[model samples]
Target: MSISGINNYNYQNYYAGARHNMAKTGGEIRGVLSSTSSASSNITLHMSDVGNSGNALTAMGFPDGTSASVFQADDYNPADPEYRVRYWDKEGNYTDTMVKVNDIDPQNASYLEMLAYTSYSDVEGLTKNAFGDFMNAARGVNGNISYDADNIKEKKDYMSMVKELMQLQYDSNNLPGYLSYKELYDYMNDKING
Candidate 1:
């Protein structure tokens, strides 16, 4: 039972009564509801309830959901372990990532915290260096990436000097890049940092 057929709402008291009745039935009233007596009209405006999804927000008038936000304002915090930004750079030889360098405040860190960019290709070498540091834990006093004697390659003179210093090489040729690359990259990180 909707009192919607009458559009000529000529009085203040009657319009208020209709609005009040609509509220009681739990039906949303959108658009204009007004009184002919007042110069100002009653207008109902609403935002499409976008429940935290970027795509959904984008559909509701935000441009691809790239709105400026606090999460987008997080500075690079090398100390914060929970934050990570991933970008696709199939154009480059390396997977692109941007790591902010700081410890995030525990009280304020949210699901949508911190901002990062992966399109900074000019810094791939530098970015890789930073990621290498992260993977090797070479950023602090608590971390010390080292190779055991068995993992080190023996020099000809050193081998001759020490006949017992023989080592079995890690055979990773058959392994997938996921494993081999990680091990090799870790080793490289260790060597570089050490």
Candidate 2:
């Protein structure tokens, strides 16, 4: 049950029949296990076969020809990353293709900071206006400037403040006009933290 130091397994030694050949090349192979049994389980394997002149092919095999397929580098160029392996069927229709994969690298700290600053600057003007309106409404009630109509002025003032904050967050985050409940929560967090 304890598997350690099993870093690599070589399969070139497993091929025995004259129908198969082996070569050393750099690539990956993927397959799936068919069943849970140890002896009767079916396994598929792929191999990169390189000729003497450094040409390569990705040979794949399964239990049947109709179910299994192989992809090989047609225009084999050793130095190019854009080179790919293409698969085809007996009818000459394309099936699958493989290409080099890479991940995005995050190395520009200054650019990230500039993006954050620009995002902040783009929303500053709207935030200021919203804050001003909320403060004015709050002051109108506190100063008794609207005494005649109703005392719901305090509630209205608080609602306006909430609306202003919500708008600020929404506009800053570039959220859609129709706000979802989860989006509102995320906007609040991003506004407070970012």
Candidate 3:
């Protein structure tokens, strides 16, 4: 369960570790079909048949294996009561944790949509403050990141504040004189725009 030594991957050893873990966990990879074409010298895969195959997705769709639940992504609205996120517990058991939009981290909002099976609307209600908090924590801005809480309520304004904070942090770091101001500015601009 501890993969500390495998932090950085070496292509040669990754598969060996993966196979060992797979065997130990009784993990089965379904719906993957591989076929090689002799003439074309290529391989093709057909995976359209795999529908909601993950453990959390399966549990949400058919909890009892017979009756399908009424869990519909299209039906989810951010203004609704709450949003539920599915994550694996320490024992490898899938657990659904309901969270409010305010508590959602803006940095991992899209990741939550994919990995946790949360909807876009679930994170649509996140405020500027939440994004600021995520940026601060991620960048280690601490008390250095400053913004007018009352005036800068819009998302765009908060993003500008983040760009400023990034610039401040970059300036604070005493890099070699060879690194030009334009280089850092361009890098920060690209990050902010992206």
Candidate 4:
């Protein structure tokens, strides 16, 4: 029941350091929604507030008529530390999206724009390494243990692919105004693997 690229030990260290940084910079509240409600509650709250003030769509930098929907999986755990969103546009229809709960300073306006610009899965689903895992499992290979080198390489490769795709998006004038291409790349890498 473990997921790669998410180390609780490393995350604890990161959180401690991030908290310290936030303290030094003055603790700023972070989160897309103004209400400090639960994620499930937020879903209902948002669904009811379309085109109104303080709705989730507007909070996410979308226009008045935009919408966001949640697909609550049976095993969904809002408390999971590794949780992140995967979103994409469905042509002229509403943006297909999921939700994540993490504190981010609302004052940092670029945060929403960054989220919007990178409106795709953080990890490209069904990667070669992932398929290999399935193949191994099918062959009765134990999934409990994995080589550190392969894990590290997979992480690097995934990040590299994401960076290249993001760069291409940016080159096409898709990046937000607040970040240069380099800044966006570094920021995403740090967020994913810091």
Winner by TM-score: 3
Checking candidate 2 for backbone clashes, the offending pairs are none
User: What would the per-residue lDDT of candidate 1 be over residues 17-117, giving only the tens digit for each residue?
Assistant: 66775675465554324332132432222222233311211110111212211112124333342223322122212121233423322123221221221
Per-residue C-alpha lDDT of model 3 across residues 1-194, encoded as one tens digit per residue = 12222112366576775575556546654321221122333222221222242222222211122111112332345454344444333233443445453443333333222222223222343221332233342233344432221211222333343444445544556232113322333433443465
Residue by residue across 1-194, what tens digits does model 2's lDDT show? 11121111334433331112212212222111221122343433333434331332223322232112222235534343222333333333433333321111112111112112222222333222322232233333233443211221122323333344446435456343214322333433354455
Candidates in order have lDDT scores of 0.26, 0.29, 0.33, 0.32
| Candidate 4 lDDT over residue span 127-168, tens digit each | 222222222222221234332211211212323433444454
- Please give the ranking of all candidate structures by lDDT, highest first, separated by commas: 3, 4, 2, 1
Task: Name the runs in model 2 displaced over 4 angstroms.
Answer: 1-55, 64-80, 90-92, 95-98, 103-194
Q: How much is the lDDT of residue 191 in candidate 3?
A: 35
User: TM-scores, in order shown?
Assistant: 0.16, 0.19, 0.25, 0.23
Clashing pairs in 1: 76-100, 76-101, 77-100, 77-101, 77-102, 78-101, 78-102, 79-102, 80-102
* Model 4, backbone clash pairs (residues 3+ apart or across chains), number: 1
